[model samples]
Target: MTDKTVLTERNGRIATLRLNRPAAMNALTADMLSLLGDELEAIAGDKGISVVVLTGEGRAFTAGVDLKALRDSGQDLTEGNVGDALNGAARWVQQLIERMPQCVIAKVNGFCFTGGVELMLACDIIIAAEEAKFGDTHAMIGLRPTWGMTQRLGRKVGMQRARELSFTARTITGVEAAAYGLAMEAVPLAQLDSRVDELAQAIAKNSPGSIAAYKDLYRKSENAGLDAGLAYEYETKYEIADVRERMAEILKRLGG
Candidate 1:
């Protein structure tokens, strides 16, 4: 249930994954990334698990990659190997989360910076604490994001806003993030967990097959042209064989 840096707890069909290094603000180290990947892989294979809520144990969801570890590694970025390794891990983790059949929700409790923002971009939904702060400080750190930030962030917010945030390395509060369309909602810190649970439970109550299909469909169609997206949706309709039965069930539940 708990690794040194990552803790996983399950309640019914929902699994909560916490970045456990609270003292260091859950700054990610290479070992932590590997452990997180392992945890996600295990959860992905478990059919009984339908939702995952990713959060941090302490004051920050994550302060991004552990700069101390990177500095100590002493790998020259000009040599490309070090940058490649780091970028590769980030990309793999983000893509894995995006592609998993189970829905992933980011419960942003506090600071979410640099690579942490990239992680949030990959989730299906993000519910942030009112006190949470978000930023992309890659520029300030003399680095650029290699994860999907450049692409996904723009899609989440406007291109102009994404440019302002990344270029300026400015931080935004959770309220601002919601206003900018980055998070689904922002709640008081006290209500963050309960709000996330309410949303996750609502999704969990739906048909698992339909949920999985819908998640996949949305991801696939989001990048396509409207006509193309419509065509894809039309084609995917056949993939869900129980639509009529589901509709009937809905009617029955409505006391029809």
Candidate 2:
């Protein structure tokens, strides 16, 4: 088997990104993050692709940062080089998921912990299998989540729950994760693939421009205060107003 950190493939309108380091449980490295960013950027400009799904090969989605790589770096986590190498992947992948036009989905199975959990939170939709486990074990390992975990987790599952999860660094089952709103849905391991395909196909059938706008709306709303969100909605509505006008003109020309 290949040992690349990342792999990509286009399946008709759906692009699949697989984390391929299964021997290490797909623990992320800096190169993987850069590759994923490059892939997302490429897909953004490819009209043939309409949606993107992120998953991992073998038993785990990802085991977070590569512990062995950290040891090999011979640099303290507090230092610039090793920390940058370790965390940069998470940063770039998170940013790519946020800015990409395609509908991003996390098809998670097995261990989705620490950075894996943070990365999934970046996705627009997360669908996990029954056997998957989600957690933030950073604190347990004498580290803290420096990603957007503190901000996004609470918005996902509420402040109280986020505090409990991050502070305790406990593992939550896929079903419990679904209940906490961490996942969009949880399916049996056997049916997970079909469910992801069904959802991806449904998303791919929608207007690409409309889907992009919808995803942006969530991001803006998530970061905005009530008043600011309302203002953003108005601005977005004004922007889309032109699309409606053009649509009407097209229908008129067709004598519909």
Q: Give lDDT tens digits, candidate 1, residues 45-77.
A: 887888999999989999998888888888686
lDDT of 2 by residue, 18-129 (tens): 9998888888777887888888889888878879999999899998877787778776765323376657767877988987878999999888888888889999999999
What clash pairs does model 1 have?
none
Worst 10 residues of 1 by lDDT: 77-86
List runs of model 1 lying over 4 Å from the truth. 1-3, 78-82, 237-248, 254-256
TM-score of each: 0.92, 0.90
lDDT of each: 0.87, 0.85
Candidate 2, residue 161: how far the Cα is off, in Å: 1.1
The parts of candidate 2 lying over 4 Å away from their true place are 78-82, 237-256
For all candidates, the clash counts are 0, 0
Which stretch of 10 consecutive residues in model 2 shows the poorest summed lDDT? 237-246
- What's the distance in Å from true for residue 127, model 2? 0.5
Q: Cα deviation of 26 in candidate 1 (Å)?
A: 0.8
Q: What would the TM-score be for candidate 1 when compared with the true structure?
A: 0.92
- Top-TM-score structure, candidate number: 1
